[model samples]
Target: MTTEVSTRPLQTLLAFPFHEDRWQSKMLIGIGLTLAGMIIPIIPGLILMGYVYQIMHRVIVDRGSLYLPEWDNWGKFLKDGWRLFCVAFLYSLPTLVVSFAGMGIYIVTFIGAMTAAGNHPDSPASILLFVAIGILFLSIGLSILTGTLTFLVLPAALGHTVARDSFSAGFDFTGWWKIFRANTGGFLIALLVITGLMGLVYIVSQIFSMTIVLICLIVLLPLAVGFYVMLIGAALVAGAYREGVENLELAELKLAEASIVAVQEEKPS
Candidate 1:
């Protein structure tokens, strides 16, 4: 029987730079293909997003570092994703409502502060400080909340079990301090690296003429980064779940295998 344990760290879904598995390479290519497909004008971005999740779901099931399904598989995966997307999207409705409310409050606070200070807005430094602080706090909170929502809803659409659970599961996972502590450092490091690379790309692209072509290319650079980061984030979460939540380490699997063999031999089989 196949063990349900997750694979090794170097072989996890994140497909980190050091990962040498063929599946990892294929998954990376798959992500690139999905992103390129998304950039097309007429096709709905949701279609491609669905495919990405489908591919990810298959990867998880295969227990491999990468998963590249055939073209037909892509179609089926997209359909499955669409079905799940509807459910997850509906589940996320409350989050969307709250987000809108938060934005409204944020805008209102800033406007009210400015209006209270009147034409001499520069005079009330305290008001300006309060407004700035509120904006910063709101932004940080939104960033974490949205990031958590992405983890909860997106993968479930792709076939992860958590998506089927109540909406509270998403908040619970995100609020779990142990999970945060385990994965936050790696994510921040990835963010800094990607940011630096994008910065360099932007600088190099700007060396060309300031025509529409250059501007569009510059815009595409960040989109490319954004797509990669999403995959990376998914991978990190997959890794965390495999180790922390599922408790399915490769070493434990090997030990179990050895134990099974010893037991069989002792049984006179």
Candidate 2:
């Protein structure tokens, strides 16, 4: 008999990074790379994101293993990171397009409003100004909503893509959607847990920032916390995916068994 894989989002979130004997060194490297990425720019950041993707991939393949992976294979990290970037970029395109369009409308209307105000103060210039302001605000709200939804959906998409080792899998909305629907509760819980962890880190960072000496740590502290949080979040997401997929398989199996039973009953009677 096959043992059932259980979902332990909270346990995995808090323990995965520290489960290994060399967790200290591993975490240090991760945090150091994150800081370096912040200082240097694109390349290191991409590599780090790719490393996080590996964590997700590992969890899925290993049936939710809690050990942190060693920081090796720079070439693979860079390549995988590029794929991660592409996935994120494509997902974010809708928000970007909306934002740019809104900005364009706002600019044109603002200019018209100013031009009209200069010539005819009592004309529709004020109305145009109001419309522009309204559009800008509306765009900002839409962008935020779209961006948040994208962030929530991204982990599931990335998990599917990473599992298949295919960049195109990230774009398979119908596929991921089915997986996501299978365990929406699990995904939402993971999201809430990660969000809470980040919020707690932010609060602590703010407290540290208040001190003169500790204020110096504001930069390093958040980076370290954020890196760990990323690892934890990735693991949680992968676990959720595993649970969701297994649930789907089990459901299908039960359906098949029921159909077989029904067919046998119909034939004999």
Candidate 3:
């Protein structure tokens, strides 16, 4: 049976990383992933993303804590990372298209206006400028909204994807809809926890980037804030996934028992 105790989401989610067991080493992995993630041709970042997903998988499936996952599964990590990349990429398509189109429109409008001004054309440059501003704002707002949706849905998609060990699992829209419907409150709470962590990371980093000494800290520990926030976010999603699976499992067990009892009732006494 799934453990129903320790239901406090944040507390349970953080218990692993905060535990007294080799937390320093776990932190070292976080730091390493963060710094390595900052480098180059997307490989390092993808690996780190896969590793974090594995950490979430362990928690949600194996009922493990937020302990650091090992780097030994490089092949598996690459594969999983590739799939997660697919999921994220697919989900971000709308946001990407909107953002690029927005930027393109802004650039074209800026250049056209500049030429008009330089040539002193009779066209209403002022009106064009106002129209450009409105278009820019609207496009930017749409991009931001879509980007936010990507962040919100990616976690749920990732959870399902990893749970089934299939990339297509994440795209199972009907299944996800049911899961979301059944666990809306818990899922929102999880999202809220992650959002809070985001704000905290921003505040802490700003505080750490003030003086020369602190600015140096930020430079030396460039990935610290990001890694910490990511770890917590992964854990919150893991907890939410576990809760959803547990509910489904419990319902299945009850249904099985009910069927057995009904069969017995139909049998001769």
Candidate 4:
């Protein structure tokens, strides 16, 4: 008798070929475009985000990899990015509403608690308690809900569907919670590593003694770091999406192939 192996749950879509040909060149170009996008000043951040979104969708989703043509079709990418931004903005309304509404409730609860405690302004204990409880609830609720939304709803938006349909798709995709749970440790580790690297970059620049280099650093460092961070995030999200979809396709293919093999074996050989 042979022991059977259990099928592991699917991990987040992260299928980008980080080690493949011309990836570094594409990454550098992507970062540069992201930085130039920052020069617009007022809405530069949003524009930069749009650019990153475009690169991810166009290069990763459409091209089947992140090794894209360097600045060859940026205008088209930007257009797609803008379209995605608008859709994502609309999709995110519920999250924004929940955040503000939750904040309002916390404020109201705090005020009520303070009033009940006494008219004394020195009573911070009650306020502290209110904040602690509020933050705890927010952290738990927001992390889980946002994680689920990002994992599920993003696919529909990426696929250019309506908000309601996207949300429904998210609900369906999110039913496989075990996959998310299994990958939690890896996600947390990656998050910490990225955070540490960013912090180190900030710290090293501040400690440098060369005045001219320091001045240049002060101006360019934040933008560089920000762009790089955005690129990494976009890549990771794109990878997760690809991984999920491909895995689903692979499973279907395997089942079909197995069925064909069974039928052929029964017929003659």
Q: Give the number of the best model, judged by TM-score.
A: 2
Regions more than 4 Å wrong, model 3: 1-9, 249-269
Compared with the true structure, what per-residue lDDT tens digits does model 4 show for residues 171-201? 3435323333434444444455456667877
Off by over 4 Å in 1: 1-43, 73-75, 83-100, 109-159, 162-216, 219-246, 249-269
Clashes of each: 1, 0, 0, 4
lDDT of 3 by residue, 1-269 (tens): 78676657556566656664677776777677668766767787777678788988897778876677756787787788888889889999999999889878987887788778667766677466666777789899999999987776677788888788889999998776566655667778888977887787677778888867787676554477677767777777877777777787788899999999999999998
Candidate whose lDDT is highest: 2
Candidate 2 vs candidate 4: the TM-score winner is 2
- In candidate 2, how many Å is residue 117 off? 0.4
Model 2 / residue 225 / CA error / Å: 0.4
Model 1 TM-score is 0.45
Order the candidates by lDDT, highest first. Answer: 2, 3, 4, 1
Cα deviation in Å at residue 105, candidate 1? 2.5
Ten contiguous residues minimizing lDDT sum, candidate 4: 160-169
Q: Per-residue error at 40 for model 3, in Å? A: 2.8
Candidates' C-alpha lDDT: 0.52, 0.86, 0.77, 0.55
Give me the runs in candidate 4 sitting further than 4 Å from their true place: 1-43, 58-65, 68-75, 86-95, 112-216, 265-269
* Per-residue lDDT value at 100 in model 2: 98
Q: Model 3 lDDT vs. the true structure?
A: 0.77
- TM for candidate 4 is 0.54
**lDDT at 41, model 1:** 50
Query: What are the models' TM-scores?
Result: 0.45, 0.91, 0.83, 0.54
Instruction: State candidate 3's TM-score.
Output: 0.83
